[model samples]
Target: MPLYKTLTPNSQTTVKIWKITETYDDLLEPISLKPENMKRVLGMKSELHQRGFLSVRHLLLEFGYTDDDLFYDEYGKPHLKDGKHISITHSFTFSGVVVSDGIVGIDIEKQREKIGVIAHKFMDYEYQYLDQSDDKYINKLIVIWCIKESLYKLFATPGLSFLQNTLVIPFTLEEASTHAWIDYQDKKYRFDTTFFEFEGFTCAYALPS
Candidate 1:
């Protein structure tokens, strides 16, 4: 089990990251999935996605839960049966989950220069502080993208716009954390966001504050 990292953001929240190095059969050997999830995983066309899905089940075990303890809403946000909040994300070789007493979201993304091509799609207020000429431009954009994605998962609203509604407050890479807001339907919600990099991938998470 390559349980790569664990973070206790607070007393009530736990974030666990896994490095996906096991074969599909290896991941399946220790755990049994619920019927629906088994069917869902089997239908996935990509082996990477299958492994990511199975890897999450292992993370659930680390949290003292199981596939039967999780479910998805109409909007496709995952939830715990006991009422605790949970958010999950996986990209390439990394997968992560955040479990908290309050609403929370997590995202992991590989650092890629190609993000610069679509930066305009999701960034506006952040551009004021971002320096494209700097070496950290791609890192900063990945953080922003993860922040917005986490916020979207946290909010779980039907039509929230990453560009128009989500706002990531400025912060340097050294800060490791910042704040963000979501302005939707005349109301605003604030979150305290944190991010970190490991093995060329960045993981960002948000907790409602």
Candidate 2:
């Protein structure tokens, strides 16, 4: 059980992270998944994905929930049966979940330079503050990307564009937190974004503020 970290951001929210080191069989041993989730896990082509899926179940147990208490909306956003907001993320060997009283979203992404090549596809206003020549460019990009992803998951609205609609305010890597806005269909929403890094991976989460 590589339960890496647990964080209580507020009285009504909790975040849990898992460092996956268990084999597929080992991970499958403890939790009994609902039939649909079991079939979903079995149908995953990559064993790494399977393990990440299973580790999330363990995270749910840490919060006293199970697969039976979870469901996905048409947009694929996860929901708790008790009506609490839930957001989930996984990347490489890490997986995480955020349960909150308000709308929330989370994402974990492996830091890599490859993101630079496609930065323009999902970035617009952020370009004003990004210095491609800076040594921390990749890290900065990853944080912004994760921030947008979190907001997207929180919104769960179809046809939203990361580049056009989601905007992350200027912030330095040292800040580790910032503000973001979603402007779509003549409506504006705001969220507080926070980020952290571990073992070459970056995790970002957001909550309606």
Candidate 3:
């Protein structure tokens, strides 16, 4: 019942969203973070980390999988017993998952009032189109951030930064739908993005070109 939207980027991939609420059954269970994930969650600022994990677990349940059904390999990528390509994300009260027979990715981010200081780290050519001085800037930034995060999750690479890589092409944010492309090792990827208001955050998912 958590699916918010479904998208088909190509004949081979499908991406879906889930809005995890407090009523979600898994929210009450004690978190059992794996040692590796614990390293990051334990050091995180608390609420964000806990909410993220709780959301992810609930999303798995929506798919008929449980917390015990997930395992992370040495590369830090999560592996499901069913062997599907998966990506997980949570921001504020929203969490999302993208699963595909092929490679997939997804991301969700809290719509902050201001992302001023950190903008430079993620905004590149997309900056020219952005009216950072405008009141709508934070929402615009979240759109770009979610798209980049999806691409990162899709590739599962370590050193790529949104500012230097992830090309969002060009699109109008007018109708809550956008298109983007990413070039990874000479391969071009096409992504279709849609922004939805969910639990006070902006959520997006992407798949192969």
lDDT by residue (tens digit), candidate 3, 24-70: 23563544545665565556676655666766766676666776678
Off by over 4 Å in 3: 1-26, 29-48, 185-187
Any idea what lDDT model 1 has?
0.95
RMSD versus native structure for model 3? 3.9
What is the TM-score of each predicted model, taking all chains together? 0.98, 0.98, 0.76
Instruction: Assess each prediction's global lDDT (C-alpha) against the native.
Output: 0.95, 0.94, 0.69
Q: Give residue 52's lDDT in candidate 2 (0 to 100).
A: 97
* Candidate 2 Cα outliers beyond 4 Å, as residue runs: none
Note the residue pairs that clash in candidate 3: 190-209
Per-residue lDDT tens digits of candidate 1, residues 1-209? 57999999999999999999999999988998999889999999999999999999999999999999999999999999999999999998889999999999999999999999999999899999989899999999999999999999999989999999999998999999999999999999999999999999999999988
Model 1 misses residue 187 by how many Å? 1.1
Pairs with backbone N, CA or C atoms under 3 Å apart (clashes), candidate 2: none
Model 1 lDDT-worst window of ten:
1-10
